[model samples]
Target: MVAPMGIRLSPLGAAVFCLLAVGVIYHLYAGVISNRYAAFRGRTSVDLRDLLAVSVEAAVLGGKEVKAVRDENHLEEKSKGKTREGASEPLTKGDLQSHVKMYNLLKSSFPGVTVNSEEHDNLEDEVTWSRQIPDDILAKVEGGKLVPANRVTVWIDPLDATQEYTENLLKYVTTMVCVAVDGKPMIGVIHQPFTGFTAWGFVGQGSNMQRRSSYSTNPPNVIVSRSHPGQVESYVRSAFGNGTTVILAGGAGYKVLSLLDMPSSTSGDMDKGDAYIHITFIKKWDICAGAALLNAIGGEMTTLRGGRIDYSASPLNTGGLVASIGVDHRALVDRLPEWDPERH
Candidate 1:
């Protein structure tokens, strides 16, 4: 039998030892979360949540330290004939396309993550996905990913609300990055890279928002685009006219990012709860990742008429959808005075 040492472990020491053991075990388990699954193969079996997290990490995780310079060399290439059906100006034809730069930047952080785009022929659905991006765009998009139910493609009037970004508008062009899964937003992640603002929602868990400010609150804030106006403004005015106010944000991502924080106006209005949910205007690429993020965070996504959006089958998946959180949803829709909105 082993003899006990004179220095017996006190209760406190014993408790500390137990906690250390638990911590060590947790650390080891966390380190192996992805690896164990690595050997667990199945092309379509990857969890949307994990993949979404990986994508966000890839896009943002190391934004500062790394500087991805735009391929000015592609300027001449862009002048050539290559074009992605609906790419905006300035991004016209290009050889060493900006996609190469974006892909390289993403690869630097995502490591093995791949991006791919191909002509998808979903005969059953009668849709196709295509784009002539630099080959690198194919890196991160895997073959069997869980696409948002309602894939959307949005056309922002201009990049970053050119006029506002020029004047350094704190918030202008703020809009929604809407996503839907089974006609509801399963994930949504709105981002404003310039301000490092990110708002995400995953159905079943909860929706959260973050901003550049060092402040925090628990109120519902409504986002409005100074450059892009929408019925949401009318809703805000109708709902809380005197007390509630709409904040100006630039870009779809910026609008959703603002939702992450309870705005100043709604600071103590519990009656207001959370702001409206339907972001009618949506663009596919604009909301693809955002929708995925929202789905991962536990939220329902769907078209205005509540239809599923298959992101995988098509490229230009632009459509209208709503991302709601704690509001009289059906009642809100009923209020819309549209003769054929029933068909939207």
Candidate 2:
């Protein structure tokens, strides 16, 4: 064994020792420090909450930017043909260029993050999972396991309700983000750019509402998509027994907000009334954010036949969906025609 040398340290030595000790301590508690920082920023996922906030701001601003430029160029009429179903606008000429540009910029920051956006379909870019589902939620999923970050996926609708937006129906347009692990949506964000209203929710952490409102009406208001208002009338009649009023609305996210009964009035005293049902066969991006909101508030959003949607399975929800704020979900689902998963 080597004998200890009794060499005394100078002042500089003590300072260096203190610095090294502090560094080690910080390193030991690095996770705690990181958690605190996440909390301070009102975030939990490695890059989710902050990414959503930034993406939303960019989308909102981009909408305005695009609209302003459209007006200046008098391209509104010229763009009409492009908005139709199964049509494409020549990107080389009159592209709504800002939408993809803003989305790509926001997405690029999170290297290797898998994303399913309305503007692009690139499955190869899906990244590994870097975050775990919260304990409370994870406990409920039978044998649910957290995989690598590369398996995680995010769905985005940078500008939902494109037709409504082009028609100048500003309230209907929204920006949406949904985070899924394996094939389940665990977090969602919905932002209405024009109103600057936002709703967000995570699996176990609950939800946040920029505007809070309650459901207090008896008859229960039902909102339907403007594009497909008549599709669910019979279902509504069957579910509510012919007394509920159907309100034609645009955008799945906006309609979900209505179901939340958030007050839209400036006075802030008006009652939004109660909402009981929203049913549609829209895309995953259209309803994923809404599902998060409904789930947080103890509401239910399931396939039209009342089946759980696996977000990772497919972007198109051919089976349709029924979401509700108040009522027995299973009972309502049972009321529909004989459930057929294959037909959805």
The best candidate in terms of TM-score: 2
* lDDT on C-alpha atoms for all candidate structures: 0.38, 0.59
Error of 2 at 198 (Å): 2.3
Candidate 1 residues 188-272, lDDT tens each? 4443334444444445544454222232112235555454344556655554443555565544444433333444543332112
Residue-pair clashes per prediction, in order, are 57, 11
Work out candidate 1's RMSD over C-alphas: 19.7
Model 2 regions more than 4 Å off? 1-47, 58-63, 66-95, 121-147, 210-219, 261-280, 339-344
Q: What's model 2's lDDT at 269?
A: 32
lDDT score, candidate 2:
0.59
Question: Could you estimate the TM-score for every candidate?
Answer: 0.45, 0.65
Deviation (Å) of 206 in candidate 1: 6.9
